[model samples]
Target: MNTRTVDARGLEPPEPFERAMEAIADLAPGGEFILLLDRMPQPLLRMLDRDGYRHDARFREDGAVEIRIGRP
Candidate 1:
């Protein structure tokens, strides 16, 4: 599947979330929005869950959090 990535490691508050949300909004059908972060994003995960969006977040071998989001 095609993917759009937002590398948010070391970014300040809101910037990473902003970039991820933007990328998610612009994703093509059947594409994925991948967010790379230093830690898991609880707020984003909650929002996705509350909104019934399909999302998966896992820790990479390097200890980074990788979140994949698909359209609801």
Candidate 2:
């Protein structure tokens, strides 16, 4: 499967969310959207949940959050 990475680590609010939304819209079946964020994106997570997308979030050693989203 192909994985599209969106680096939102230094980005401000709304930008990260917008980028994530764009990635989700462009995601294909059996593919993944990897979002690198500076903090836990709670709002984004909620949106993903409401949109019927499955996702997982993990913290990196440097304190960045990595959110992986995919279709069920």
Candidate 3:
């Protein structure tokens, strides 16, 4: 499976999350989206979950976050 990684180290957390959703909506019909962020908020994560996007998300102690969006 091909995955696209959006490095959100410099951008604002919300922007990266929005962009990741757009990317998933655009590309995930055929493949998947692998979102990588330095840090993000919990509410946004809950929003993603409530939106019914099939994902595996986690925040590391080092402040890195990984969110994988696959078929719903």
Candidate 4:
């Protein structure tokens, strides 16, 4: 499966969320969207959970968080 990545590290509130949402919306079945952020995106995680998507978060050595979201 191919993965699309969105870099949201320096972005302010709502922009990262919006971009992630847009990416999620455009994802095909079995596709994955990876979000690179400065910190954990709790609100977005909740939204993904509510929408029944599967997700995982990993912390990078560079102090950024990588959130991978995929269809259930």
Candidate 5:
């Protein structure tokens, strides 16, 4: 299936982070989501990992980051 991508550039860091978590929580067992963010807190990343979402995140040249999550 095509992955769902959420661009969080307009949201406040934590707000987007919270929204991402909410979206993940609402997904079915075999869901996939990708999030493009602009500087978020580390705690949020940790929380996401602990919840079983696989992620690939890094700082971008445009001051944004991308995180990918795929359920197994």
Candidate 6:
């Protein structure tokens, strides 16, 4: 499966979210999107849930987050 990655670590509010939204929009069917962040992206997770998108988030011991997002 093809995968697109967006590293949004250390970015302030809205930029990370915006970049994520853009990357998610451009994902092809059956493709996956990986997002790296410094903190948990609650809003993104919530939106994904509300929109019924397939996604999973993993939290590292170092306080980083990796989210894998897929098409609904």
Q: Top TM-score: which candidate number?
A: 4
Candidate 4 ranges with C-alpha deviation above 4 Å: none
Off by over 4 Å in 2: none
Provide the lowest-lDDT 10-residue window in model 4.
1-10
1-72, model 3: which lDDT tens digit per residue? 557777766686578767876886686454667777876546756876887767778886778888777656
Order of quality (TM-score): 4, 2, 6, 1, 5, 3
CA RMSD for every model? 1.4, 1.2, 2.4, 1.0, 2.0, 1.3
lDDT of 2 at 26: 84
Clashing residue pairs in candidate 6 (N, C-alpha, C atoms within 3 angstroms): none
Q: Give one digit per residue, the lDDT tens place, for model 4 in 2-72.
A: 57889999999889888898999898877888889999988888988898899999999999999989986
Instruction: Assess the local accuracy of residue 27 in candidate 1 as a C-alpha lDDT between 0 and 100.
Output: 71
lDDT of 1 by residue, 22-65 (tens): 98778766677788999889999998898667899999999999
Clashing pairs in 3: none
Note the residue pairs that clash in candidate 4: none
TM-score of each prediction: 0.86, 0.89, 0.69, 0.92, 0.74, 0.88
Candidate 4, residue 58: the lDDT equals 97
Give lDDT for model 6.
0.87
Using lDDT, give the best candidate's number: 4
Worst 10 residues of 3 by lDDT: 24-33
Compute the lDDT of residue 67 as modeled in candidate 1.
92
Q: Write the per-residue lDDT of candidate 2 for residues 1-72, one digit (tens) a residue.
A: 557789987887789888888888887776788899999988888988998888999999999999989976
Candidate 2 versus the native: TM-score?
0.89
Candidate 1 residue pairs in backbone clash: none
> What is the Å distance of residue 66 in model 4 from its true position?
0.3
How far residue 4's Cα lies from its native spot in candidate 6, in Å, is: 1.8
